[model samples]
Target chain A: MSNARRIIVINPNSTPEVTSAMRDALDDRFLCLDIPEGPATIVTDRDVAEAGPRVAALAAAQEAPLAVIVACFSDPGVAETRAAVPCPVIGIQEAGVAAALALAPRFGIIALSELPIARHRVRLERMGMLERLADEVGLSGVSAYAAGHDPAVYDELLAAGRRLIASGAGAIVLGCGGFGPRRAVLQAALGVPIVDPVLAAAGVALSVTGGQR
Target chain B: MSNARRIIVINPNSTPEVTSAMRDALDDRFLCLDIPEGPATIVTDRDVAEAGPRVAALAAAQEAPLAVIVACFSDPGVAETRAAVPCPVIGIQEAGVAAALALAPRFGIIALSELPIARHRVRLERMGMLERLADEVGLSGVSAYAAGHDPAVYDELLAAGRRLIASGAGAIVLGCGGFGPRRAVLQAALGVPIVDPVLAAAGVALSVTGGQR
Candidate 1:
């Protein structure tokens, strides 16, 4: 209840289910917004690039947001949104990566699918955190489109998690925002830290939520 | 309450007030331990190195700890404690740094004293996080010995916070666990994200706690 400041988590995909999942994971302070004009889901660099301005537009329209969390793993419009808004605009991938760093020396990320792997690499490079990354593995069949509603996705996540650990990852970061609630499950199964980006953003949100403007 | 796993926050310092401050900032899941054999305050690299094995010994003696948080800002014994403990051993400096990364591209640290600057640089280099730090400034006179008991320390912290911001820090990390309770005040005064090192470790604690061994 103390996380009672106004923070908007904009899911720049047309999936209401993803929005619902985010709402379930976050508290009342976080208003999860689903863009009707967005792509089915963001996966490839193309999807991420296309989703950028649409997300930025929606983010620009929000009234007095203390902070905005770009909830997509590909982080569409995160840079543009920050310029558009008066407050901080955080990306889930960056938040999850930071959470991973907090836990271990070498961390791995499990993405929804292999398509966004390139995008993540670029973001990691920009953040200067690429050196600490052990590796990033993607689920073979779990697309970002179905990630929100699929309980079956957990199996794929667990399998990828095993490979990440075997690859020398000390902690695992769930790169997709759709993997929000399954963080504990992965942590228990993998016996290492599992970072849920949405949840990770909450700590940053709590720190700066009143208003930086 | 979901951070229900047993996590021990070990303050490798002789000051009980610092331990008490940690307990207040954290929840019941975090059992704060004040080491009687440690230095009254850890500032210099000598203080950090000396406290290492002593904190490691205390950590080794604890039974069934899900994770151990080396709650000192200097993070004494963190490496040694990790080797001695079966579960995760997180240091507040690393956690605070990661929390800073979550909020912004570049961050700053406000330490208890200038003596720990060299030690922090060594640790930051080891973690591969030195580049992300905008700056690390220490309060002129505050010691870990009196940090826990001084409500008056807020003024000193605010002054340092301004300097860090001016030096291009996007967020301010309370480098000392002794600065845990004053996070909100600093955040408000500085108009930037304020990280409480003790609290930052909790999110990492939650992800990996309840037995990573």
Candidate 2:
């Protein structure tokens, strides 16, 4: 069973609390990997630069992967890692957006902070899906490190979810891997689908890996 | 049980055989309703225009619905229906594309003929996702009415699937409702995830409507 082909979801940030929260958030069906080399925290574009090569290198070194997920919403090294691996390399943001699109015509994003909001925009634009983003809000001062563990992040996310729905987002995406645990409770409050990016990527991975072929 | 909230998957075209096949292709969880007023078959842009308002009116009149699906590959009237409906209104083309994005970076679409191929391009262009399309191929002479019952349509689809894989499609989408039943079989032969547009839309509906909100 240990040798069974697995989907590896790499949490690129090196902060232990962040990694631990992400590991707990992900389903047991996937292998949650925390790299020893990326930036200790991804608070800015500079941190994303520091994390990309480490993620690419880490993913390239994996064995028997059915798929790999770049768990950061910024998707720092997903493109590079895709070419380096034989299996599908899914980015959390893209997977989440895809799922959100299925749930509703337009979607909103809940980013841990401003940097990832910009990152999400860039990636969506590149994928030609920026138009589908109804709106995006960032938790003020809540870094990815804090988002991973602090329950205090709840109220801010809920308030933002209301505003996003008011802005015409039929569904919302938890844009940080750290926000994965908050999806269900938030969706219940928001009364719309709340997509957890890591879980969304895992679902996509499972669809591809569920069968032997 | 009879009055349970349902997802309405409207086949949009009025041809009886087409409706029958789509009913067979859809999982029982959804209610597949073929319109009495759209074009007899959707082959050209004129048919799309004729089908659009009929789809909108039919969708608006539905009762106790969790979601509505515009099941035609051309997605006639999806935008109009979305505006008319209180719940999620899913179009098969957009849903299929979203599922394909989850499976891989680029996807190929299999259309029934030259006309639906054109409609697919226009819609993808409107969505700003035209760039992500690897390629699209159509069965040379098959019409939607014939496609629904004819098993002989298999070989052309298989040949097209091979070329699409060669053209760099990591996944292939069955772009018409009639193509839905062939999905699992063709996917086995092609070695990639084959997206059935109706089923893809259904998955999204379930995500949004699965729980009573």
Candidate 3:
């Protein structure tokens, strides 16, 4: 029997491509796991409203001490997960925002869409970083999850980062899971800290959860 | 023998006036126990550098799963107290930032001194609200642990809030323990959402600690 503790990373979306990308990005970071990796559940419902409770239920059913990561950029189920779990539970939005602040005095969030960008701005305000923000810019026509499997998704994200920096952003936050797979590439291209909310979120999950696996 | 859980709010400064002010402010909020009130502790250390760990050791000595609030504006021993207790440990800085974000899209922090203001800005960055700030203004020469008793201190704080609002702040955050004694007065004076970091921090400790009291 392997001794590695199980850690669950929940992708609050129905998309397999996004989940696959997240798995690949995080897999190398956990090479020391002695056992098979835990399940990565993708919510079939693309609806944001239903995502929280479903993910929370999944966490509740897993009988033992389990560290859970809500992989969505919106951090669906994060508050409920914290209330339900005995161990540490983290939301990507929470972890990502916290980590970005650690690296840069200010950061600009680059959301997948204009509508969500406003919502994200509210979210940041709720978190109390409004002054820390130089600005928040949205990618006008693209949504990370809606991009399907097109390689052009990556290019759009890279372009968005450049635009935010041009507007005087000290750091670029990859505001969605679809961008998780391209962190290093975008960071190199942007010449500034490209905050893959996923990586930062996951790193914090590891710290708070003490998830050795 | 009271079944109610006892929570100690340690002001971390030896000012009875601040302690009484904090007590009066919280008088109606917490449930009336057998004691009918929360216990308060104040640090005798008038010195800054010696305060942090000294207060931590005091919090470490409690026998029960007691919730302790390091009431100092600087949150002198919060991290060390968390290390010493299995229950929830909260810092006023962390709680205030988190709570203020819950209410407003942006808030300005009014601190005592420029050095302490820098420290608070760092804390907000750590809390992920660096970007949500409208401003961080300091009272010309007020000190966190020593300013609570002086009426002139309130004048400086009020001035700071005015300047913050002039710079486009939608809310105000009182960023020190010495300022806790004046939360209500400041809140009314500013006519904005004035977040008293002490109360915000205490509420978080209560939520996470699952206080039986």
Candidate with top DockQ is 1
Candidate 3 overall Cα lDDT vs. reference?
Answer: 0.59
User: For model 3, what is the error of residue B47's alpha carbon versus the real structure, in angstroms, after optimal superposition?
Assistant: 15
- In the range A44-163, model 2's lDDT, one tens digit per residue, is 888788778888888899896877989888888887887788776888888789878766768899887766677778878887788889999988868667665577888889888999
The CA lDDT at B207 in model 2 is: 48
Candidate 3 regions exceeding 4 Å error are A1-3, A28-46, A140-149, A211-213, B1-213
Clashing pairs in 1: none
Candidate 3 residue-wise lDDT, A36-64, digit = tens: 12223222233455777877887777655
* Best by the TM-score measure: 1
Better of 1 and 2 by DockQ: 1
Which stretches in model 1 have alpha-carbon errors above 4 Å?
A1-4, A148-152, A207-213, B1-4, B148-152, B207-213
Count of clashes, each model: 0, 0, 18
Q: Each candidate's root-mean-square deviation in Å?
A: 3.7, 4.5, 15.5
lDDT of 3 by residue, B1-213 (tens): 255555566666554556665665553323211111222322222344456676667666665544566666566666677677654455666656654554345668877666576666666666566787889886776554445667878788888889988877765777776575566577667765566766665544432232101
Best by lDDT: 1
What's the CA error at residue A200 for candidate 2, in Å?
Answer: 3.6
- The regions of model 2 sitting more than 4 angstroms off are A1-8, A13-41, A46-65, A101-106, A143-151, A165-170, A191-193, A206-213, B1-8, B13-41, B46-63, B103-105, B143-152, B165-170, B184-193, B206-213
Give the TM-score ranking, best first: 1, 2, 3
Per-residue alpha-carbon lDDT of model 1 for A77-182, expressed as tens digits? 8878877887778888887788788777899999877777877898899888899999999777575545545678878888889999998898888887777667
Task: Give the chain B TM-score for each candidate.
Answer: 0.92, 0.93, 0.79
